[model samples]
Target: MGSCEVYPQTIQHSPNGRFVVVCGDGEYIIYTAMALRNKSYGSAQEFVWAHDSSQYAIREGNSVVKIFKNFKEKKTFKPGFGADCIFGGFLLGVRSNSGLAFYGWETSDLIRRVEILPKHIFWSDSGELVCIATEESFFVLRFLMERVTTAQESREMLTEDGIEDAFEVLGEVQEVVKTGLWVGDCFIYTSSVNRLNYYVGGEIITIAHLDRTMYLLGYIPKDDRLYLGDKELNIISYSLLLSVLEYETAVMRKDFNTADRVLPTIPLEQRTRPLSVMLFKNNCLISVLLNYLTRLSILLQFSGEQIV
Candidate 1:
């Protein structure tokens, strides 16, 4: 807010990098980042930015989260009880001491209610999936948004009782996730044990091992590379093809039709990349996965180049 004298509890930058929000002391002020000029100010306890950055939300003293679209108040409603943290975006999400609840942005209907307290939540790039990270494990769920009208709200199909069937559990891992995000249908993460792995179709595979702890910055789809940074100010990258993972997932799901369509799309050199060590050691899943991969004539050996 133009370098105001008041100290803020936290500063939030919009996803599009156009606006900045300063929040503290039960209020927030918006500013145009480039001009360093104040745009608007409002009362709030907590603030969140929507996915597209076209709208924003704030938790008010009314115990409700308010959505502001184009600087005009559009929606406001209280989430499930005990929800203390706002994680709003394309969907309205709030986290409490015991669980997390989500609501539809347009109808304010309960979309999901889960009993797991998460340390981090990741929405897929296209908003088709979401990954919830807990202290002991992480799980992925597909996000479903169905358009409904008030006339259909009371129907048995569109009850406010929450859409449990829509948010399907894609996969889950017992390992603690340090950092990660989604790339296509696969979720790649750095585990607490310093192992980089990808989870798809209920299978977990270790693709690389980190000699030292590092953080995953992001993946560059154009370059087909994954970038990681360390506390020592060093940046490293690795070749991670998006199409290859997609093909693997399709095969795991037994969707040969999708696999056939995706296989030819991968580049020639990237097509033969080595398969990683799958997590079959933990349980009886090894024999099944091993026999499955063996059927793939393309995968004979496994070895990947490590970047230091």
Candidate 2:
């Protein structure tokens, strides 16, 4: 048709650029490589594109989980309780009012379910343990190895151990705004501790940005870089290079922690500035700089070749 109608939720091009996925408040629409359209699900609280881009998952507020492959229904999971879900590889982590649960793809079976105060959940690459977050708390849960042998099995696992109060309750957990979570070789989330914090995880590391005006946008695990944009139109990148203990102590969780700098720059000095930034590859940064006042967009490319 005529340039495919723009969506209100959010539209994202797959990393490979073969497909485009749109997320409405409670729905997701998938457009194929050739621009074929498919209606996936409805009443979803959130949506995540699979790493391979072959399928995507929807987290329904009613605790009904669904996944579609090639625009066909692959599987459906119902937690039996209202829960929020996050995905990694073939694993799905679901957060509920009572606790958290994990499930495997293909087979709609439970991996592990913990009955405790639930918050946010993150599964490492290995998928052995998961990090859970609450108001101002964080905890880890280890999966029983013997249970999750494969998807063909029953797919039930036990929780080994977890923390009740993971970190020191600093800032107002209610006032703390959660943008999103980044997972890979490192983890960076837009969360406010005392102010706004950029958490870098890997080899036990975490970094917090004290500036209230700054917000974390994205993270590239391969390069260990985090992209931050401020209301002042300053786009900066922070590369992870130190350990978490180097800034905070094991006994006390301090928000006044600072890691070493990587590289900081503004993508758009003119116009109203870039509303978004994407890391394509080394030296080549893709930015969608906007001038709302004039209602224009300029795709800016920042590279070393042009600097000289």
| Tens-digit lDDT string for candidate 2 (205-236) | 23554556566676665565667787788888
Number of clashes found in candidate 1? 0
Per-model TM values vs. the true structure: 0.74, 0.54
TM-score of 2: 0.54
- Shift in Å, residue 266, candidate 2: 27
On TM-score, the candidate that comes out on top is: 1
**lDDT tens readout by residue for model 1, 127-228:** 887888889999888865552333245555544445556577877789899988788778889999999988876777677899999899889988889999
| Candidate lDDT (C-alpha), each | 0.74, 0.48
